[model samples]
Target: MKRIFEELAFVNVFAPQSVEKTTDKTTAFVDTSGAGEVAFLVSTAALGAGKKVTVTVMGSDQSTGASAKAIGDAVEFSDSVGTDPQTIVVSYQVDPANPRYIGLKFQHDGDAAVLCGVAVAGRSLYLPAANGWTVAK
Candidate 1:
């Protein structure tokens, strides 16, 4: 038998730094074909006073993001307190019926360009899993 380790099946990195404050970024589509769960992480430098940024997780059927669309409403993060730097993450459970590719989009509304990193991680479902689970002595 093998330890499942909740294997990290795949990862995609975007905009390690140098995110333009006025431009929007749509990341390259990442294949999520076999992952059972996916996590999206966005780490950003100080967001500048009164500035705002929006993070969106989207899905597409094509690697070029030809059919891209947000999975849900874009989430907004603001530096209401001024110069707030933070890391935010969103997780999604893979649905076999949905498109097999996903990506991230960042929209910045501020005057200062911030250093940011976006990472998408795909994790496999636990091995030896069945339709139901049970505990034994």
Candidate 2:
């Protein structure tokens, strides 16, 4: 099988203003429309002790509005080694019927802000077509 990769979103360094709050914390959304498989990757440069980060995959039927739903369980991480870079990765399969666009939601907790970078990527595999050409190439 041939594999194709696409970058959904990237953040060199996280900032407070780049996120939207849902209830008590902040969230960053990444659009992964028409993706068959997705991988959410998060990296922290200097996460302080007691700090926590959660990455959740969200989806919606329309491009905008309140029809969004959480696709899967949120993947969470806590600072184990202070001042050390932490990385988190989560993978999911997209449903074709619903959730036309996928959203990556980042949730932050604790007093100290998380100094981190986040990237979302999608992977698709295709077999060779009748003409001996793959979908990616």
**lDDT winner among the candidates?**
1
TM-score of each: 0.75, 0.61
Model 2 lDDT tens row, 1-137: 43332333343223423332222332344445545676666665655676677776677765552466777787777877666767787676766765666556676664554454555666444445777774655
Q: Pick the candidate with the highest TM-score.
A: 1
lDDT of each candidate versus the true structure: 0.75, 0.57
lDDT score of residue 88 within candidate 1:
71
TM-score of candidate 2 on Cα atoms, chains taken together: 0.61
Q: lDDT for model 1, please.
A: 0.75
Give per-residue lDDT, candidate 2, residue 16: 28
What is the alpha-carbon RMSD of candidate 2 to the true structure?
6.0
Error at 62, model 1, angstroms: 1.6
lDDT of 1 by residue, 1-137 (tens): 54444446545567577787768888777877666888887888877777887888788998888878888788887777665676778777777676778888887776767787887777655556463567755
